[model samples]
Target: MNKILIIGAQGMLGQELLKIFPQAVGWDREEIDITDEKQVKQKIIDFKPTIIINAAAYNAVDACEQAAEFELAKKINGCALGYLADVCLTLNATLVHYSTNYVFAGDKKDGYQESEPPNPVNKYGQSKLLGEREILRRSNLKYYLIRTSKLFGAKGKSTMAKENFFAKMLILSTKQIELRVVDDELSNFTYAPDLAQATNILWQESHASGIYHLVNANPRTWYEGARALFDILGKKVKLIPVAADEFSRPAKRPKYGTLLNTKFPKLRDYEEALEEYLKDRN
Candidate 1:
């Protein structure tokens, strides 16, 4: 049996990995600190896994505005990814790393592809892109960079979907409900279970080692995404369309974070995936 090890196993994607790969070993935040290169290296040595999937990342969007956390993500996601790449090289193991589409600045009208050059507008994107570049640099190692976007899952407890910010406006039962959503921002929404399944489809095939844009096939504005989400929740929610400049935040969100995969059979359109997710959701 191939020993598969997953870091950040408590998160949305990680939780789905455990379900998809029943026998894999998983490490939560308490179990392993990905920031420490030495600890991660040692963990690999101890586990002696045949494949290592890193789902760990500093995903705090607002917090990434701080220089310290942004630097931390680079150290953990990039530096540590490099460290693990060396380990995989030494141990002769396969490595799968998760990345974000924020690597692209979304200046172009079309979606990002596996071949497009990255120009991240924020610190989070910069850090994750650096990680992708660092780990992928090792030619000898078996590595796959899976770039995904707008992930949500039931297993992910503290997700933005679970928040009431959008719900209050969507459910709109109370008179105090006043909501504003960005119409300018566009992205490909991905559910964690679907992403996990798609990743597994490629991971199961030994030859699937390369950069893949793994988000859902369709693109939607932030309002549409929220509307679909509220529809899934069975709450009556209406999103007031606004521009990117309407809401003031520390970091800038990508206007179009859609990632197009022209070749993957396992991936489907975002609308299809969303329908599936909402259809079965409780």
Candidate 2:
């Protein structure tokens, strides 16, 4: 049996990974801090896993604008990855790291492909991009750099309590009669369970090790996603579509962060995944 170690095992995607790979060893932030090089080094040497999946990331987009926060983000998202990659290389373990679609400028109308060069528009994206570069530049180990977008899971009951966008919209629908959502930004919405399934398939079946765009098929705006949630739940609410500029935040989002999967089989549609998530929620 292959020994698998999952960092950030308590996070949204991390939780799903734990469920999927129940035998895999899990470490949350409390158990191991990736930012601390000493701690990370010690843990990896102790576990000596055949596969190391880094599910941890500092993903606060707007908060990353601050000088201090940006530095921390880089340390966690960028520099920490270098440490993991180096250790994996030494241990001869395959490293699996998650990235975001934010790496693109979103200028492409059709959506970004895995081969497209990354042009991050904000501090968060830049940090993630740095991590990707670190892995390729430093590590000789076989690695998978998976880029996804708009993740939602059933781990938490509410969006405020959980980090998922779909749960947040569902929570808002119950309280607010009307909601304003950004329509200008376009991206694929991914369901965590479906993503987990695809990831496992890639790990087991695919021999090629490189960047893969793993996300639900069909691009849609945030507004459209919210509308679909209401329609699926048989809830009627006034959803107003607004441009990305309408909401002012510290970080800039890609206008078209949708990702195209040219490597593996396309995952299920966003609607199909969302419906399954909502059904499970109920």
Best by lDDT: 2
Q: Once model 1 is optimally superposed onto the true structure by TM-score, how far is the C-alpha of residue 205 displaced, in angstroms?
A: 2.0
> Which candidate comes out best when scored by TM-score?
2
Give stretches of model 1 more than 4 Å off. Answer: 155-176, 231-235, 279-281
RMSD of 2: 1.8
| Global Cα RMSD, each model | 2.7, 1.8
Clashing pairs in 2: none
- Per-model TM-score, in order, reads 0.90, 0.96
